[model samples]
Target: MAEFHQSRKNIIRLIFIGVFAVIAMRLFYLQVIETKYRQLANAQAIVRKLIYPTRGIIYDRHGRVVVNNTALYDLMVTPSEVKHLDTAFLCELLGIDTATFRERMEKIIIRNSRYRQSVFAELLPPDVYGRIEENLYQFPGFELVERPVRNYPYHAGAHIFGYIGEVDSATIRRSDGFYQAGDFIGKTGLERSYEDVLRGQRGVTYLVRDSRNRIQGSYAGGMYDTPAVAGKNLYLSLDIELQQLGEQLLQNKIGSIVAIDPNTGGILAMVSSPTYDPNELSGSERNKKFSRLFTNPELPLFNRPIQATYPPGSTFKPVDALIALHEGVITPQYGYDCRGVYLGCGRPIKCTESFPGHASNLYNAIAYSCNSYFSQVFRFIVDRERRPALGLAEWYRYVSDFGLGKKLGIDLPGEYSGYIPDTAHYNKIFGKGHWNSCTIVSLGIGQGEITETPLQLANVMCIIANHGYYYTPHVVDSVEGDPDFYRTHLVLHRITANVSDTDYDIVTRAMAAVVERGTATIAAIPGITICGKTGTAQNFTIINGKRVELKDHSLFAAFAPREHPKIAIAVVVENAGFGASWAAPIASLMIEKYLRDSIATDRLPLLKRISEANLIPEYILEKKRRIDSLNQVRDKLEARRIVAR
Candidate 1:
């Protein structure tokens, strides 16, 4: 019996030892080798919540709000946490039907993980969000996330303040995980150019959840939580009043106007006709309205100021004169016989300025816009070199310094580099050294293969106003952080030519003469010293195997108070009869408005006339009619949707 008792004690000790070893191994596995299981269990009890940051506010030069923010709510769901809920009631609250609800749930399951959160409904306005929040606790897995959506107070500058949209797969891939699938991003214009600074930084928070998935407040007493940083605001140089006035002047016309502060190279106003209210691209009906506007036949989406290109026409004569003076090919006293026509290059170039001073001298030629004198001067500059190609290339260098034929590097997207014809291009088309100065003399008057956008033309005026230098024309004047934001981006460009201050003075004087007594006299202001040039660009295109001519494009470029210039402007009106009639007056009025902040009672009729004038061609009108018809359907649908809510 004593031997049996000893055996029992040994067996009991061994069994206890074996049980302890097993327990130790299991504890080690749970702590190290099989750690993922612990994390999974933690995830079930702890909620990781994202904190969104507000996008930047945009202000005009005078501290007026251009873009602001309004609060909106998004409905979120975790499919795995969802249980038996009132589907019909939820769908009605979210403004979705039964079919839509089913489709969304299926998409969540197929496209996203069941454990991860997904957006069920997006962009609910304050009213809708307030109503839905009262009944949200009734649903088990539903949550609300607050976001700040864009709001436009004035409802102008649609293209300037591009709309934000959800990020696509391509965007996410390009973002390097910085942006997820549903994150909002700027699509174009200033919004796109300053996205990094304007998007700010996101934050995160951790909260505990009960067995029923109800929030139990901050986890770890908020020790690990981070607060979101709001985006930096932008102070723009644009004058909203001036911009609105310009838009009104350009109404019913298919063109653009660009006004810049000559001293700072800050854009004062930029107007593209056929523009839409920016608010239409914001708020609840944004996507639907955007679809209709995107497909409109008039192409209101096109940003014309920096994108549309045209020949500079008579306005180019000033540059030609400057080039000739700089090269010593011609002097200020240079004169040529002008009988209102140019008969040199096997073609008769006609001119409307048959007045007495048309051929007297350089100043008179420029003021009167005498095509013949400029054509002769252009030939002199080109033929100065033995080889015509060499002379043309030399001339091109001067024009290129004025920021033509290249992007101005403005803080906007989709700027086109206007075309500048080169010797190689000419030689390839017309053989080596076969083309002479007379062959392409049309270039002297800003025609042929040369083209310029209104923004570039306006910069040319800014350069002239500054007497040979310019800061790159930019819209944003200052940013919140980094006081050197504007200065760092400001490009101070100087002309690479031997142009003298006297030459600019002489040019400014002649430009003043243009408004004083020449073709652009209609643009004269009572007290302001206005300098301007009128331009009529010939429109030529091939039709039915023959070149056909359309109505001329009216254009003008000007600056005010020639001594200490404040504003420089360029306006182009498509299919208008004369620059003096349409473009000149418009530019003049804009200059006056910017300087005096009021238009004289006398100019009211001119403003009314230009505003009411319809310059779109018949074909464009017919297409617009079709777009209008389709938009009627969209309007009805939008109304019904509003009533349904």
Candidate 2:
């Protein structure tokens, strides 16, 4: 009996020890191993506030601050903490009706949980903020939070600088908790491309709250507060004056101009016409203005420099000349007696210059932009190989090396890969063996099935200027914090074409002749040696399911100061007729402006003519008118609905 009682007592003691160990482990897990319960408990007494750092400033090449920040306030609300709120007073302060206030509150609750804070009124005007701040203590859950909004001092570079907006659900998901609702993010252009470098680290502050949900002081004496790191500034290669001039010249027109510094491939100016003020998409009216811009028929939002594509037209002749010379099919002195037209194919292809011996050699041929001469050259190249496919593949390889038919990987977003037809493309269209050089002769003249962006055309000029090498074109010259940004991002890319430097020299001379006395003579600047090419791309539109030819698109590509070219530029004026009339003159003025920093008195008249010209298509104008009328009607209806409510 004594042994039994001792064993039972010992078992009871072991049970007590096991229970104590389990209780101790549970306490440790809850206190140290898990954060959910602790955070939930802290949420009752501590309000965590996010501090948004100032977005990086943007500077032009000359160190002018082009983009800066302005202080704005957002009326934030924590729905759960909103007790005994004066709905009418709040509505009156916000300049909103009770219905609108309730609607906004409902949306906030839906988007963010009732316990969390959300923006009630964003980008509040200074006057409105002053009024709300005076009475903010009357609203229990409402807080005025200061944030930085972008400001464009010059009101230029609407497309280049882009805009930022509140983060969407998709963006929040993609950010992996880095972004939340009400966080602003870049939507396009340099803003979108350099978002990471421009958006600085966010900081957090823990504030102690009393039982009434009022902030008392910094939680834990500010021990856990983190300071926000301001975003790194960006120094851009864009010459603001040059950019402004380009925009001025392209006003009331549908076109694009891209100018690059040949030595560094830094974009000097990029202009897409019909541009709006950058301020239109900032501050309080951003959403309303953005909606209108998005629906505009002119497509002002489109980044035409790298997004729109057009045939290279005669500007492509130099590339063909180089290719022919490399293939040994034509020498620099090779002559084609192009008298009006080429008769090698069943169909006749006419030359722009009908005079005899106009295209007597490669130099004259390029200077004259003779279609017949290049057609024969393309035929010789294709027919030289046993199969036309092999010849086309070779041509494709050469052109692709010049950065056609692919994205140039420019620093901007939404770049379109211009199309270049190859053997496979022809095979799919006309069957493998049925198509030959004659079937696709237009490719030689950069017309049928060959397309390139203005960026690509400018890049081609850079290659010619550099004797077959180019750097990836970029806008940002350097980031403030990172010194190796340019070297690491905008590296030199050499063309793999087998053409020698002599071939480039031959082409360069011919291009100079083009500006000196040939097709683009009007593009000549008095002191600057401008080597340029004129292009008139045939444009077409589908009207009522029928292909309708429209006025040709005027284009010009050029490099200045022939010996050591500083600037390479491309201009495309949509539906503006002959290249020399619109595009060439524009290029000349731009070149002179960039080189001299001002248009000469002699050229001001030409600049005035080009700048005042209105080339927007009639159809586009009619469409815009119709859209404006519809928008007016919609606005009236919205007003009526609000009045009825």
- Candidate topping lDDT: 2
* lDDT by residue for model 1 (475-585), tens: 999999879987787879999885999888888889999999888988999988888889989876565689877788999998888989999999998888678989999
RMSD of each: 3.2, 4.4
How well does each candidate superpose onto the true structure, as a TM-score? 0.91, 0.91
Question: Whole-model lDDT for model 1 versus the true structure?
Answer: 0.86
Question: Once superposed on the true structure, which residue ranges of model 1 sit more than 4 Å away at CA?
Answer: 1-44, 95-112, 125-131, 540-549, 631-645
> Clashing pairs in model 2?
none
Model 2 is weakest, by summed lDDT over 10 consecutive residues, at: 35-44
Report lDDT (Cα) of residue 123, candidate 1: 82
Overall lDDT per candidate, in order of appearance: 0.86, 0.90
Error of 2 at 271 (Å): 1.1
Candidate 2 displacement at residue 509 in angstroms: 0.5
